[model samples]
Target chain A: MTGETVMFWVLAPLTVFAAVGMLLVKKAVHSAILLAFVMIALAIFYIAQDAPFLGIVQIVVYTGAVMMLFLFILMLVGVDSSDSLVETIKGLRGVAITTSLAFAAALTSLIARAEFGQEPLGLVSANANGNVEGIANLIFRQYVWAFEVISALLITAALGAMVLAHSPKSSEARLSQRARSVARFRGASIGTAAGLPGSGVFARHNAVDVPALLPDGKPSDLSISSVLAERGDVQETKRYALDGLPKLDEEDK
Target chain B: MTEYASLLLDDPIWLVAVKALLIFVLCVLLTLLAIWGERRIVARMQLRVGPNRVGPFGLVQGLADGVKLALKEDLIPKAADKVIFIIAPIISASTCFLAFAVIPMTGKVLFFGEETVFQLTDLSVGVLYILAAASVGVYGIVLAGWSSGSTYPLLGGLRSSAQVISYEIAMGLSFVAVFMYAGSMSTSEIVDSQAQWWNVVVLFPSFVIYVISMIGETNRAPFDLAEAEGELVGGFHTEYSSLKFALFFLAEYVNIMAVSALATTLFLGGPAAPPGLSFTESWLGGWFTFIWFILKVALFFFLFVWLRGTLPRLRYDQFMKFGWKVLIPVNIAWILIVATLRLMTQEGASQFMLAGFIITVVVLVMLATTIYESSKAKAEAAARFVPEMPEPSFPVPELPKQKRVEL
Candidate 1:
């Protein structure tokens, strides 16, 4: 097989698998990652098809910008939040299945009927004056209005987001609150004293200011102590508390 | 494909493999040298002695570290996603190598009785290919963080992804001017276009922006907040150990080299000799151009190390703000001016007049905006003024004065 054919065969299946995996993956993060893989695969496919401009655009725009945004949002939301399996709306799953099946069938039929070897009308070969120039020509000349409209739509979307998220009165109130907090903080010593507990069992000082010492003369409520206590591994704790602090004897009380 | 690039495809399979192998070896050796150089340079900057034990001047210290890492016990956190944890470092290290594939090391050189460019491969969209590879490298870090199932790592990964995305936008915008000037994205073609003047000379603003964005993009010092040791404690690789950790380290240094090479390719004219220098060209039978390329790349590497030694990491918010607000907007404006000038010059217009006109317009617009912004700020300050509060109704208790004791 030719290199292009070989590449197509490899990348096409991988792309399909990744697309399917994106839906099948339980974790939202994994799905987002799989979508990125799909995008990269599609970009390779574009390159193999001699459309270097489209391939690069696919990578730069879809895989790089959009998928990164998706992953960013997903990670921020936390990976523990998996996709809910429950059907929120009655008959929604059925509707989805039906629509997807119909769409798939329509797409399959359209592809099967399409001419594979012939170049499309008004579309220049990628080798002619470079793919970038050819694509630019098409974009700025033939499809200029559509491109402009799409860009305008993006701007409008951004505006709508601002309108939805912003409120002048609330923002002003928040700003005033923030100013007050800042003033309060400035009036006091910029220390951890504000977070200290008032009292504790071994309270010589505030709990947050000074960690309480346990009867064993080890610091109480430390991360190591908590983790060890949770795991019920007290024997392992001795290795961690090897700082050579004197242990409190029972008679010393 | 351009004639320069076409020859690359016509190379025999074994030659291509040899070139790929050479690139791999060069990247690794550069990473090692960079590590040693960074340590030695930073130590000198700090007035301290660096590694001098392993080999002469600690040149083999990187090798020692590699051996040490390989010998160390590999540890996987109990909660980590096993598959992803394994794949993450591989992704990082591989992508670092991938970006070097299109970087031309030298002009046409005789290879076993055939002329070929000193590069692995040349794509039509070579620069974009590098960018794509760099972008994909983000995945390795993000995945490593997420798969660790830890807090600091997740935060680091998130920070890095956001940082990469923000900087990538600026970096891409900066490239637009270079593309306009070069009239092609292919690295070899760009190098050819720089026969008269390097892109850095013509597209100074883009170069500046690219340098800043490259630093941010590579997550080097001053922009390495993702792995800020003071806060994140090793960051995304916190949960990794042994060879995996080494992979992350290797990827980091390789990324530095790749980015430096890219800057060399795009701005410093990619293996081309400096203008009006022909003595060195004949000294090594024309192989001296490769040395020039290496020197330019090394200079960039030194700059990276110097910044690391001199500067402190930027706060995350400030870094993001600079990337999105300052670098990107400035890059866009610069690109617009450059593109206009290029079009005018191409159409037989006076280059000086067109450039001057664009610069004048840009300056006037900037001045107008600055004045308007300052006035608006003054108005806001006036509007935000608050009257002082009256005295409290309840009497405040006064503390008793401490008795003065003189020692």
Candidate 2:
């Protein structure tokens, strides 16, 4: 066999194995990193075609930026929970394997059967520049709008992520207020709600008026701090109020 | 057939591998030499002896240090991600070494009864390869930080990763100008493109942008926010010890050397002597260009040391802002200018007319922008500071002749 065929055999398995490894990885982050390996393998495949520009772009854009973004999103959402297996299905697994195998079989047969072969164009020929400039020249002239729309979509995704990540100003303030009110209501005179302590739905001489926007809107005085206390960890964040510094230490008593 | 296999058949695999190995070794030695040179030069500047305890005016100081570092007790923190921690330094060192494969240290020399370049190898996509190598080094730092299971190291790694991404965009934009001028990315062909005149002259703006990017790329001051000593304490290598620590150190120096070598190759006309000095004559053999190349690299090496000594470290935000805001935008503008000039030249425009027109246009644009921005900024500054009119100060503090005590 020619060296080209030998090289192809070596590289083809690498790409397929890496891609399969990427898909089969249990941890999402590991999967993403494996996908980078697959992208690098594919980049090498492009190198075999002498499409160096596409090869570099494949590695740079896919492995570098997009995968990094995916990893970041996974980290932000906190992967590695037992909830991941909640979507697992035995029937889907069988179908996935069968379909993927069939697809691979069809693709390989098509490749093997094709009589198409190419030789590198001469140095001064039209194909010499790897179509980077030529494609750009044509693309900007024709599909510029689509390219811009893709860019806009990316911007929108970025903005959406930013919006989702940010806590609304009013809700955080409301939570902080709830915690502070709990601290304020540890008095003996108040009609404390159902709890072990004298803390909760307090009444000062028959005056127990709690704010709306808490659970179920009515002034059932369901006691916001009691709810937060049940939740546990958010107490520190509740203490992240406007100068809870002195009062928080007092509440510990 | 001529194109497909002639190049491969010209040189045997063993010979090429040997050259590759030699290039790797040479780059390491170059890095060692650079570290020593910087210490000695900085010491001289500060009027002190540097590394005199080592062999012969501290000539082997770097070697001694390397050996000492290897002998130190290796400490892997209990909390670090063990696999990534182990892999990080290797990744760092390997990527830094890979960039030199395409850098022609000398022109074609006769080897093994065939003509083969002194370079390890040259690919059509050599420039992008260097970019990839440099970019991969960022991951090593990132991995180092993340693996360490320490806060400061992680911060250092993240900062470095961001810094790499920020600077790389500007660096890529700068390459567009070079590509437009040379019409190729192959390093050897790039050098050949500069056979008439160096790209450093025609693409000076690109070279400048690349210089800025290189400084940021190598994490030189004032761009070394990744390892800011005051804030990060040892930065990404904080948790590393012994051979691992040494690898990170070696990687840092190797990257510095790689960038200097790249600058030498790209702008200083890779192994070629300056204008008027031709090694084409038989008296000056092909091997001699390597000397000139080394000297150019040494000059850049000195510049790196000089920057470290001279510039204060920039704030992290300011560093990123400089890369993304100033450098990338300026680079894009420069690429446009370079492309326009290329178009003009290819269309048979006279060099003098083009230069004159470009200069006038640039000067006018710069002047107009400066006036607009400065005027706008002046008002903003006035509004912010709101400087009140100053009254003459009385030394007695307007206390109405209270107590003549100069005591």
Best by DockQ: 1
Off by over 4 Å in 1: A105-126, A166-253, B1-3, B350-356, B362-366, B369-407
Separate DockQ for every predicted complex:
0.17, 0.06
Please list, in the order the candidates appear, how each scores on TM-score for chain B only.
Answer: 0.91, 0.89
Report per-prediction Cα RMSD to one decimal. Answer: 8.7, 12.3
Query: Which runs in model 2 stand beyond 4 Å of their true positions?
Result: A5-15, A24-27, A72-253, B1-9, B279-284, B349-360, B372-380, B383-407
Per-residue lDDT for A118-200 in model 2, tens only?
Answer: 97545346444454664566568788999889999999999999999998776422324444344434433233323422222
Give one digit per residue, the lDDT tens place, for model 2 in B1-407.
21212343467788888888888789789878878998998897778878887888888999988899999999988887677789889888787888888787776566566666677666767888888767656667767877787788877877777777778888878888777666777787777777788878978878888888888987778898888999998888899999998888888888888888888778888888788888451234467777888898889888888877778888888788888878887787767776777788789998798989789878988897999899998765544442233333211212332445596
Considering the two chains of model 1, state its CAPRI-style docking category. Answer: incorrect
Per residue, candidate 1 scores C-alpha lDDT tens digits across B1-407 of: 56678889889999999988989999999989989998999999999999989899999999998999999999998888888899999999999999889888877777777788788888778899888888889999999988998899998888887898888888888888888888788888888888888999999988999899999988889899999999999889999999999999999999989888999999998988888784665556556878998999999999999999899889999899888888988888777777777777788888688878878987888898999899999766755544344333321222235344799
Between which residue pairs do clashes occur in model 2?
none
The per-prediction tally of clashing pairs is 0, 0
